[model samples]
Target: MYAQVNATNSNSYIERYKAILLQHPEFTPFSWGSNTIYIDTEYTLYDVDKNGIPELIVKEDRSKYYIYSFNGTDVISSDVCYWSYDECLYEYEGNGIAIHDGGMGNMRIENVSLYSMVNNKLVWSGELMSTEECSSFDELYSFLDSLTPINDFLPITDYSHLSN
Candidate 1:
């Protein structure tokens, strides 16, 4: 009943999201090269569900992403990702849809799937296409190209210090 008791409006969720980010264990300054993701304000948030309240996307570690959303009763999180030695990428489509595509190398576990936040729960809404499903990169790219291209995402930024 977190959302029921606490959910008032979209802005409230954003504020709550900020508070959770501050207390997040993996909510640290993260960057691999030129891209840096920060947890500061609304500019960096995404409304994957189109519920007016945007969800927080956190890249916790090497290959794990924690997506948080409000279920109209309380805030909840989707399962964190687990990438192999080579993998990292994600983007959102229109209507609260998200797609993640990554994986390469010998031990790599190729994966691509669509996700959506419904009723405060993050669920896989599309079929998962892995290396087993797609024979080669060409096949994978073709599949990806066929997907809806909302490509909604904010540029990665570094404002971690601002939260401090």
Candidate 2:
């Protein structure tokens, strides 16, 4: 499920849809295609920028995804992609977090970006592929495997606790 800060209490507002979260004081009304969007609970929490804190990645729908990074008191949200199918694969390299969009089922690589905390915000520093270059999924996977990570952020050792 997706989560957001409750804005009033230390408790976080977690739910499957933005519309439901909107019921809480922390969220404001935002227009979208529907309020019935379901978020996959299987999320990943990793330090994308090696800043001693981890960012939360969750799938909002089949094509929409978000990455949230905490900065002391509040959470910063990053729109990872609107055309992504399934979940984004994250690799903790010596530099930063390498995110690959494509790998589920027959999905081909659509985009690859490296995210790191810049000025307290998660920003894309590099792009592996911006256009449709690979014709097959295997080719895309091979290309993704060959890419060199740009961010040299350290990896978080304990990530299991974040899921619980």
Candidate 3:
């Protein structure tokens, strides 16, 4: 189940989340417009790499996400999405990560693309399928599930214990 932070405790929760981020020298607090972004219902902590340490999966909104992981000492982050139209649905598939670009446009699909995390970076595999081609969301997901990882797995300490 997903944990959703309440508005009453959001301030305290942000404070705690900020404190954790401060421990990582490479982490810079993100801001949108004039306000600072904080952990809330949009964030999910999980071991995406299957390593014991949990990675911070921050879903800034329905269309944007950022994944932060501690590579032993320094914290590293990868942009899961930058723009709303090009935003991709990300998931850990098989032994690696898969990003499904559902594409954009009102009348027709523009850019239907799929990406695999090769050495912790997104590598476009090309436009194999389009949102128009899929009959259901399940079919799109199944297609993404078929892709394989390009890099070998890197194991690290589990960070789930620090999720509190």
Candidate 4:
């Protein structure tokens, strides 16, 4: 299940993604070397940074997400606020900011931060509310629930059409 490319902007990260995906219709953002949660997932391409180029976003049940950005020469990865840890959940604040709520009581905390894809890597632009501040997690999901995700996920099989 591979695509044959004749010509493309080889320097473009988008082309690189197309090459990888068109070559493997079952493309997945992760391939955990050991036992891991690599199943029951979906992906989509979106211009997450408003940079006119689409980035690959992978997620499991829309709870845990992984962002893959291209910085010209390589694919950058950032799962920080996008990922979940047992009880954590993610809510995209649009732009590059990601909101994470996890734990309870003393263990409960809210992580609100802005991130950026820099030089082939994902780096924290800045922490709006540092977890070190021990900001209590909001019990009310009203605001959070009222908001919608950047979600436009699709099966890997539908992704190959991007370059065709």
- TM-score of each model, paired residue for residue: 0.59, 0.52, 0.45, 0.54
Better of 1 and 3 by lDDT: 1
Query: Model 2, poorest ten-residue lDDT window?
Result: 150-159
After superposing candidate 1, which stretches have Cα over 4 Å from the reference?
1-8, 26-44, 85-89, 92-98, 101-109, 142-164
Native-to-model Cα distance after best TM-score fit, residue 134 in candidate 4, in Å = 9.9
By lDDT rank, best first, the candidates go 1, 4, 2, 3
Which of the two candidates, 1 or 2, achieves a greater TM-score against the reference?
Answer: 1
- What are the per-residue Cα lDDT tens digits for candidate 2 across 34-89? 76533333344566777666666544434454566665555666655454544445
What digit string (tens of lDDT, one per residue) describes model 4 on residues 1-164? 12223333434665556554433324334455764444445566765565656666655543555566665556556553344432232344455534444445776555555565565345667755544564333433443455455455665556552554
- In candidate 3, stretches whose alpha carbon ends up further than 4 angstroms from where it belongs are 1-41, 83-90, 110-128, 131-164
lDDT score, residue 32, model 3? 82
The top-ranked prediction according to lDDT is 1
Alpha-carbon local distance difference test for all models: 0.56, 0.50, 0.46, 0.51
Each candidate's clash count: 4, 6, 5, 0
